[model samples]
Target: MLSPTLITVALAAAMIGALAGVLGTFLVLRGQSLLGDVIAHASLPGVVAGFLISGERGFVPILAGALVSGALAGLSVQLLRRGAGVKSDAALGSVLSLFFALGVVLLTVAQSQGGSAGLTMFLFGQAASVLRADLLPMAVVGGTVLLVLVLLWKEFQLVAFDREAARAQGLPVERLEVLLTLLTAVTIVLGLSLAGVVLMVALLIAPAVAARQWVRGLAPMVWLAALIGALAGSGGAVISAMGQGVATGPVMVLAAVALTALSLLLAPERGLVARWRRQGAARQALRGRQVLAALRGLEGDHATPDYASDEAMLQAYLGTDAGPALARLYRDGLIRPAARLAPEAAARRWELTEAGRLRVEEGGQHA
Candidate 1:
């Protein structure tokens, strides 16, 4: 029941999302997320220039123009950092603002001349404009990016995790860095039509971030990120198709963000909920140990191996609530009620069991 146009848009968005997700893993790991933003915003002038030169909104020319502009922006940042003695952040900021301002000015001129109709869609994206014919090129480019990544997997991994170590091992760190940047530029250009210049960075970052929460290894992270990105893209496209006036790019971004939030809250071992549970368990363990140590101290003070202390005595010694800790220790067979109690004793007393004494001894040794 679906139309061919809607299907094509969905496929295109999915491909773009997968590509962005894969490339974004490296960028996020390297702390170069701003680089994606720089490339995305800086490519705008190239898009306008491509349209101006071709006098049409052709994908090839526009893609070529954007690649060149984005590559130049990347190189400019490097040159500023090494040649001009500027900080990395400063160079990126400068190049991003300069290229984007130029792009805005060029877009204004093109609009005034009345030849830039529909070209403005790249600013926020218009996935409905994608045609079936565009799918082949996107597939080819995306395939090539994946192939190159596969071939250079180990080298890229080395560079991403430790550039100095890679260099020390005689790897071409600079060339690898440039190649990664180029691949990123290509991915960003491919995504411009689906997510647009403004929201493209979100598509790049959100999926990778979400994947990171669920994975620790680079390989699994890349695979998961690609899947998340594709889902966001396709889901957004379907939602946009169902709505009357919704935009595809924003919807896709929102979907990706939602996925990220879910990952942050629910992923095992790394999510916020998981972390809170671990912290709570750790506190409980520490409290149990503290209680055990307190019982041992009370026995030592009385010069009696079976000396027993009531809950009030433990609380007074530890200056905190001891009931929960005592109950947990008792549950674990680490402590027990004293064997003997005076007839007039108002409260029952507790003593450390053999297991509890051994646990305290082990903790002391480790400490």
Candidate 2:
């Protein structure tokens, strides 16, 4: 019970999201995330050129223009770094700003001219403007890109993890690098109508980052990212369909960001809450051991049964929070308050019970 327009928009968005997510994983791992953003921004000028050339927003012309612009931007980053001795980040920034500025100028000029109705849609996307004809091309491009990604998985992994090692292995490192750049261009160009060039980087980065928190392996990460991306895309489309003036691109980016936040807070091993729990447990365990060890040392000094260590002594060894650890130790029966302490001591002292002493002895032996 979905409208055809809704279905078309959802399918196209999902396709674009999957492509961006898969490629974005490699970009993230390679420490070239900014490069993807640069490519996206660079594609704007091409989109403008396409609109001008075709006198309408034809998919093929815009895509071709974007691909060409995206490729040049990718190459410029490398050439700037290698040939001109510029820093990598500086080169990416240069290309991103320069290309985007040019695109903006072109866009402004196109707007001043006639026959540019809804052309600004490429800036932030006009999901409602998508047609059923767009779905097939999106599917074809997305499937082809995925096929290429699967085929070059190993080569991409090698280059991403260690480019020097890949080069040493004679694996055509330069070609792999270029291949990745081209794929990145394709992803950026393909997503222009979904999120637009301006906001497309969020689609590329957020899903991969969210997936990274939940997995350790590259392939699993890619799959998870793709799923998250697809969900974001389809969900955004559905949500936008419910409202009269809802924008799909921002909604999709927000959805991806929501997934990232949830992953950061709830993912089992890498989540913030889980890590805090682990650290708290570890500190509690350490404090318990410290208290036990203090008791053992007191016993070694001939304060075994009658004489107990004072809180002052324990606090000196542990920090100010020793009170909680001491309370826990006593509650656990690992230590007991002394029946009698030296009259000179003002604070209550502690001594290990027989069970506590044996436990400490066993721990020492193991260590």
Residue-level lDDT tens digits of model 1 in 325-354: 888888888889885467787766899889
Q: Where is model 1 poorest over a 10-residue stretch in terms of lDDT?
A: 358-367
lDDT of 2: 0.85
For candidate 1, list the clashing residue pairs, or say none. none
TM-score of 1: 0.95
Give me the displacement of residue 214 in model 2, in angstroms: 0.7
RMSD of each: 2.0, 3.1
Query: What would the per-residue lDDT of candidate 2 be over residues 1-367, giving only the tens digit for each residue?
Result: 9998899899888887877888889989988889988998899899889889988877788889999999999989978987899999999998999999999899889988877777677778878767898778778877888889889888898898899999898999877888889988988887878798888999899899999999999999999999999998888889888888899988888888898899999999999999999888887887788778877887788744545778887788666657888888888887888744657757877888887888798883211
In order, candidate lDDTs are 0.91, 0.85
